[model samples]
Target: MKLKKIFLITVAVLSVFYTIGCWDMVDIDKRFFVGNIGVDRAEDGEQMLVTFTFPIVRKIAGGQGGGQGGGGGSTIVVISTVTDSIHAAARQAAMRLSRRLFFEHTRVILIGEELARDGIEEVVNFLERNTEINRRGRVIVVRGKAKDALTIKNEIEVLLALYIANIFENRDICARFIETDVDEFMKQVHSMNGNVLLPRLTPGKTDVKIGGAAVIKKYKLVGWLEENETLGANFVLGEISGADIMIDIPGYKYPVVFTVTHNKAAMELLEAGDYPKFRVKLEVKGEIVETPEQIQLAPEMLKIIEKMLEDRINHMVLASIRKLQEEYQVDLLGFGEYLSKYKPDVWEEYKKDWENIFPDAEINVETKVKIRGIGASK
Candidate 1:
């Protein structure tokens, strides 16, 4: 009987402890789920304009006579505040909001071009230090003001964040833009010393276009990489999953459309002399999706088509490299990283002055394409 009495007392004590833990817990209904974050440079140039977009819980739940296409307003709400820092902005916004702003569901982070041009160090710091930020969330550089992008009324997806995040799923089909999540962005910034590429978002009337890429060097936005240039860069990076190439044949009235099935890239350091000589070899395999007219699928004709595809790919890859070397004078390619891993000895020699040496380096590109199929037509 005495042992049973002691056990009961211990159980009661543990129950009391568990109950105390819930004392500070806020109810789910009292919190707001932040869907996206936007950062822009304030007009004064001394502070940051931070915007937060979140779904209205009542409207989403259809509690306040609101439906999917209700006439009241958008299902989501957007609030902004100008403060010295992102954290401060959040706190300042809380003064006007009734519920706490929660970021565990944030799906996108948009940085305005104006602020990106000035620098993104502050944004990076906030992403790293904030424990609530989602690491899998995508980071994009908006073409204009982030505020404008965030305010867009997207009707496709229930939430604007979901709409934007889902666009990245099309990367495999279209390689026109660069995709980088918060975690990958952080890793590249550290590994590449603040040289990275992020997707560009262009706001439209009630919609947004995600294409091309924003070039970031030393944590500052330098310029943009066009759709074709981004596609070429993806080839060198071995990131091409699917791309269509149009080759105009002499006889055919229309161009032949080829779809890439597989691609592989190899880099070689032929000579590490005054101007390092490097060669990039690309092996590509694809199929002809469209043909102007039905022609004999002869072995010789296939060979000719293969050569045309090879030339087109070579031109694209080389043009992208040349622009980066001559126009940007920055190496977004993994040449430096490759040397560090494959030829550490050579990297040690050029690591100190690689920025200046890379521009003058001689790079040769070679591409070989094979036609795997001629589509349904004979």
Candidate 2:
């Protein structure tokens, strides 16, 4: 009886420690879930302006049954702070915020064009070092200001971060923008020596537009690749899953629309001379979505359409290549990477002066398009 009593007392004492719950755990209502982060160069030109957007959980929960605008006033709150570093900015914003700012739920990081042009070394460093940030969150360059993009009155989605991140899902149907996450951005920037393409976000009155691409060379924003040019670059990068090409026929009021379903590209080294000669061959398969009225879908007609698509694709790819080579004098198409991986022997000789040689290098493009269907119309 004495031993049994002693054992029961010991068991009761140990259970108290486990039943107290977590000592550092904060209640859900007290924590603010950050949705997006925007970084821009301050007006003073010496500091950074960081903006954070987070949703009000109470408002979101209360407005559940109601429509999009039902959530009290605004479901999210935006806060901005000017500081020398991102971390410092966050700490400074804490002075004004009621709840602690949390970043684990962050969905997107937007960098302003001005800051991007100056250089993204600080931004990159913060992203890499911050353990609370989501690795899969998108990293984008805003056309004008990062704060403007974040402050848009987006009604399509409850949270702006989700609205922006979800846009990448359309990449399968439209290959106009570059989709890169923080993890992939870091890897590419490190591997390519700070030469990478990031998606561009343009703000509007009601909503925002995500298209085109921001060209970054040496971690600095050099220029932008337009929608079509971005599509061409996607082809060379073998990142094209779908695209629409319009072809004009001899006699037609409307042009024929080709929708790409499959795409593959190969790079071949023709010569390793003073300026190396290269050829890019692309094999594409798609279907005709729209055709001119009364147009025949005969076998000969299909061949003609295929030839037109091939020529169109070739032109687009070559135009993008030329722009990068001649105008930008930068290789963002992984040409150097391809050479280093497959043709290491040649890469050794050209890698030293590859920057100067690449602009003058001769590059040819060949495209073959196959039409799988001509839609339901005869």
Candidate 3:
């Protein structure tokens, strides 16, 4: 009887605390949904332009509302202003908005081209210090206004913010390039090497949209990888997961498209004191998806396709390596990290002239792609 009475007393006290305390205190009507954030430098000194994307939640429905063509029905509201800091801007937006702005669900953060060209260190510092933000969020570079990109709502998604988020999952679109996450970019920035990459989204006047991976050197925006160049970037870095390539097989007038389902890259570090040369051995295996040019499915056709695929992959990989090594002068591939672990003393010396040596360093790319049949049919 005494134990029962004590249990009842505890339950009663806990229930009262839960009901009266801060539990579920935030009012839904007083909340502004934050789907994306865009950061750039303002015209004023010691200021920043922060843009937030707000979704019109009323347009969204349940059940039939979430079908493939359903979700992208809502509209997006973009607010941009200059503030002393990000938090200050957040506070200002909150005051102007009907409800407090909530950011726990932000899908992406965009950095404008102007800001990227100016060096992303200060902006990155702000993101890192904020306790609410993490690295899983995808980061992208906008050739134009980052805020304007968030305002775009033409894509087919349940939400405008989600539509932009889906752009990051485009493996078929940019299979070769690694879809960089916020955390991954931070890891690169934290490293002394400062090699990072982000997807660049170019929104169109109509409903058209184009996205490709952009390479960023330690603090500065260097260049970009388009179409096949993006594929080569993947091959050289060994970040290939699932990519498709079109090659012209011998004896066949048209080209065939093959999808690489699995691939692995093996790196071999050479002896020290040399210009840090490394061998990249690429192994790719995939089945054919389409072939407009068919010369009959003979052993010769298969062999030719295999050889062509290997050559193209190798070419693209080498091109990416050459561009990174010769043009951008950024070690976004983490080659320096590989060298440091395998050859520490060498990295210590090479560290000083890394920017100088990056272009001159010799990178040998050897690739082998096995082209399987075009499924059951051609």
Candidate 4:
């Protein structure tokens, strides 16, 4: 009984030792959170930037009208710089900042519209190679100053960094948090004829919103894609499902909107002697989210809606494709990857003359649209 009691006491002591302490715990007070990072194109073809929205012990709002008072005052800071590169900018900008710079907690990275227009690969490549930057961080192309996206605030979110992350994480029309990490982006870049799309952002006087996407071809910012075009691109790339489309019909008081609940698409290459033919097969099913007036879902009306949806999807996809073909001369659709993987023999033949073959390849697209319901009309 004595020996058992002694053993029990020792076990209890050891458990107490293990439970009460953290060996190398990092305190929240000791660290700083990065809200948003900005990048601009320099006159010398380098990157210049200003990182905005730094974290404070307590939340803060700046201005003569706004002072550090009450439970909240000024919790965020804005420190900026014009540097040769992003990492260098971070170090140089840190000199002006009160706290030490760290990227481990950075949630949003914004590239200025100008820098993106010239090319984003230079900056993005640096981001990818850096060991501190994680693949999960959300990236955006800015319409104006990248810093403004971070600094504009009057108590909208507790922390602008988190708010930016939440917008990209989940929620609304013109909202797509579709996962596009650094790895996948680089994969598309490395592919010989692959293209990539980056979600874009814009800051208004009141709020910020998703501003479509930037299309990248061969690691270069070829152009910008509108909302409808991005929807079509998502369909082509199979990046999303359950999206909505609004179409304005003549004589109709309001635009007819369709909420696409299901979509699947694939492309196949057919041999055509010295050349090859391409077939794009797409299947889409959607619910009638909103329709102004009593536009009944009659057979004819449904057929017309189907045709409309098909035309919309097709037009957007074709426009993007043509942009890639004529103006950009780069494929973001991974058509080459598809060929390389499935049709090895064709890839072997086409690889030799892909540039010559792509423009001349006969391409066809077929779409099937199904309208599941007409809301209350059902």
- What are the models' TM-scores? 0.93, 0.93, 0.86, 0.81
Name the lDDT value of residue 37 in candidate 4.
74
On lDDT, the leading prediction is 2
lDDT of 4 by residue, 1-378 (tens): 999999999999888777865663447665566766777775566556656556774544333245654445556777777777778877887677665666777777887777877777666677778987766777777777686676676467767777777776542333343346566666655665335677777887656877567776655566777766666667777655667787888888898899877778899887645767877788888788788785666788878988998988787777766666666665566677788898988889888877666766666667788988878864
On residues 168-206, what C-alpha lDDT tens digit does candidate 3 reach at each position?
576754574457777777777788545687777776653
Model 3 off-target regions past 4 Å?
1-24, 43-46, 62-74, 206-210, 250-253
**C-alpha positional error of residue 317 in candidate 2 after TM-score superposition, expressed in Å:** 0.7
Question: Quick one: ranking by TM-score, best first?
Answer: 2, 1, 3, 4
- Distance (Å) between predicted and true CA of 248, model 4? 4.5
Q: lDDT of all the models against the reference? A: 0.89, 0.91, 0.74, 0.71
Q: Write the per-residue lDDT of candidate 2 for residues 55-95, one digit (tens) a residue.
A: 98777777785655483688889999999999998899999
lDDT of 1: 0.89
Candidate 1 Cα misplacement greater than 4 A, ranges = 1-24, 63-69, 294-296
Residue 204 of candidate 2: its Cα lDDT? 97
Clashes of 3: 6
Where does candidate 4 have its weakest 10-residue lDDT segment? Answer: 170-179
